[model samples]
Target: MSILIDGLLAILAIYLALQSLLAPRLSQSVFLFFAFGLALALAWVRLGAVDVAITEAAIAAGFLGVLFLDALRDFSSTISEKHNNTEAIQSSASRKKIKTFLLPRLAFGVGLGLFLLISLEAIWQIPQGGGLTAAAESMLPESGVEHPVTAVLLNFRAYDTWLEIGVILLGLLAIFVTGGIKIYTKPDVVAKDPLLRQVILFFTPVLFLFGAFLLYIGKSGPGGAFQAAVLWGAIGILLHLGGKPVFAMIPRWVGQLVLIMGLGFFLLMGFVFMSGGATLFEYPKAYAGTLILIVETLAAISIAAALTAIYANLNQMKEEPKENESAN
Candidate 1:
């Protein structure tokens, strides 16, 4: 029965991947991609890696899925509309070119297939996990965290996690510095829908509570900063959908502070430990859990804020000028 379930999940994931790749409309592709992420999460769970599954489901399916969906909506209104009329003219011209291009494409496809087969053969020849599993388990007791995964992420592999936080902050910087996105000066119109308002009200507090719970349990279980951050991001999206921007009332300096707090604090702690004659991020055994919690909490907040800002900015760009005018 277990093997059958795993086989079914693998097949479903493959189908979803193909659908996402071949879907003509951007919206359909985006949703199918999200579905693919969720299916992969289930596969991870079946393999007993709950932490990875949660991260995959939350960040991939939740955060990235919404981001793509919003971008697709924006694209349809801005660029796609302008090209709609010209598409027919382009189509006729493109068909003649496609016939001429088919032979080359078929040749390229055959080459790609051969390359992939060779890659898979090489991967199969590689040795399976041996050293890392034994090392992690042997070192787990001294890591100052109850869960091996948490200990690895917040302690043993701290540098990698720290860099990931920096990458997310960098992404927000890229979005803002680009200057193509505009913040809405007015409330969004979606909040006016009574049903939507009620739904947001109900879910908002639930997400907040759940996120905090995830953060608290992360040191001992599968929940962690990334999962919590994604939940907070969902909260931000709900607020935006309800016409309340995530940082609407936040002052600029304060907003910037919140955005940088996670990465800054993580770096500060690393340096602090380094100055005490230990290497960077080498917390004393007694203080390891405390330090990890502090870093994770602040990181979760920063991640949530950064993701919200990104979504709010992108969503603002999607609102039709007519909606703004009507709101006015």
Candidate 2:
């Protein structure tokens, strides 16, 4: 029964991937991509990788879908109908030519068959059961977190997590350098609908509360700082969509401080520990768990702020044409 279930999920995932790849409309393709992510997440869950599934569902599917949908809205009006029709006709002709070419079809089929055979062989070779389970379990207590993945992320592989946080901050920096931080300050001229506003107002607090809960439970469960941070970022995006500039309400310097707090605190913690003769990022066994929690909390905050800043930059970019038009 489990094998059947896995087989079904695999088939569904493949279907979603094909749909995402073949969809012509940008909006359709984005939605299909979201569905593809969700399908893959389910596959991950069936394979018992709940943490990976959560990240895939939340960040890959939900967060990216929202981002793409927003960008699609911003550029949807720019598409020319005549150009679209011309492209459609050309694409149709090309499809016919491809169908008429038997040799090309045969070559494509042979290539696909070879690829599938190789993939199946790779899957079959994967060893059944856990690798490094004993090693991880033996060192779990020293690593700070009860969950193996959490321990690996926050303790054993701390540098990787730190660099990941740095990457998020760097993305925000790039956005800020390209577009000013005041992007969120400009008012959203198109007022959001009352129903949307009401929904956002009601859910914003709940979102933050849930995100905090996720962060707190991450040491022992599938939830983590990254998932929590994405949730908070999603809330910020929702608020923006509802015509609220939450970032603008906070002082620019304060926002910047929050954005850097995670990386700064992480570096400080590492250096302080190193000064005590411990290796960099080697949490003292006595305070390992506590330090992990503190770092994760701050990292979540910085990540949330950075992601919100990215959306704000996108919002500003979308409004540039309107500003230029008004100037004209």
Which has the greatest lDDT? 1
**Native-vs-model 1 lDDT?**
0.85
How does candidate 2 fare on TM-score? 0.85
TM-score of each: 0.88, 0.85
Off by over 4 Å in 1: 77-99, 319-328
Q: Per-residue CA lDDT of candidate 1, range 100-185, in tens?
A: 65667799999999999999999999987565888899998888888888888889999998998899988888987764646545
lDDT of 2: 0.84
Deviating ranges (above 4 Å) for candidate 2: 77-123, 126-130, 177-182, 186-191, 325-328
**Candidate 1: TM-score?**
0.88
321 Cα displacement, candidate 2 (Å): 3.0
lDDT of 2 by residue, 210-231 (tens): 9999999899999899999998
Candidate maximizing TM-score? 1
